[model samples]
Target: MKCLQEQAADGTHLLFLAAVYKLLYLLYTKDAATVDHVLRHRSRRDFERIEQSMQYVKRNYTNPITLKETADELSLTPEYFCRLFKKYTGQTFLTYVNQIRLQYFHSDLLQTDESITYLMNKNGITNYKVFLRSFKEAYGMPPGQLRKKQREVRDAGAISARSASSSGND
Candidate 1:
């Protein structure tokens, strides 16, 4: 019985090692064939499901979008929705929502003179510190710094264009 137990343990370890090896192999290969296979075989139902989820994300970014809300929209359980979302989009729902918020924030920085605090409040970001940290992580710079840099670039470009037009007139 002891020997049988030891053999079972060894078998489990071997299975774990095999799984690790297979994962490494897939990563090394970049697995284009499998990815293409999945994409090519994706059905209309899959596309419709993803489209609905994306629409929900876009429309509700400034609101508290719970997993339950998304799951209900798709008639899926939260767990199943999470798994399907990650599998199809290579991003979890929370990560995807943050990406959308970051994109919206970046555009607002370029186009508007809104206060950062106001933007945070408007975007459902309650924690200023966490918002700053996550924004910096996503954008490689603080929001204020990015806004300042964008303004400088825009001003410089405008000045250069004006000078070039004057030179052409001369």
Candidate 2:
């Protein structure tokens, strides 16, 4: 794909590009005409179902949701849902939920002066030990350390701005 954009092309290249596009379209739509009903439907349905599961997770991340509940929501068995979630998202179900909660927690760290425990609990992380290990693994430090570093950086920037402004006044 990058090679296609590397250089200018002439008439033969234009023809080749057209053929490639037609081939891609056929592959995506299954038929040169409408739909193939057999292969396309199965793939499209599975993709849509997986997308629906992801949206469900995003909506309910701040609440503790179970694998059984999510699987039930999509009318799939828990075992099958686990496999599908792993296949599409490249992580197990709980891992994905934790990632979402961690994102919310990280945002709150920057935006609020809340306690670490409070933020973690608010993000639906009920286990302190698990949260500590996961946070350290993902961010390369514990939440408290990350928070302190961010504060130091913010304070330094403020002090620099004030010094610059005072110097300009002199």
Over 40-145, each residue of candidate 2 has an lDDT whose tens digit, in order, gives 7766777787898889988988788899999999999999889888987789989988888988999998899999888987888888888788889999998888
Clashing pairs in 2: none
The best candidate by lDDT is 2
Question: Where is model 1 poorest over a 10-residue stretch in terms of lDDT?
Answer: 38-47
- The number of the candidate with the highest TM-score is 2
Q: List per-prediction Cα lDDT, in the order shown.
A: 0.83, 0.86
Q: Give candidate 2 misplaced runs (Cα > 4 Å).
A: 1-37
After the best TM-score superposition of candidate 2, give how far the Cα of residue 106 lies from its true spot, in angstroms. 0.9
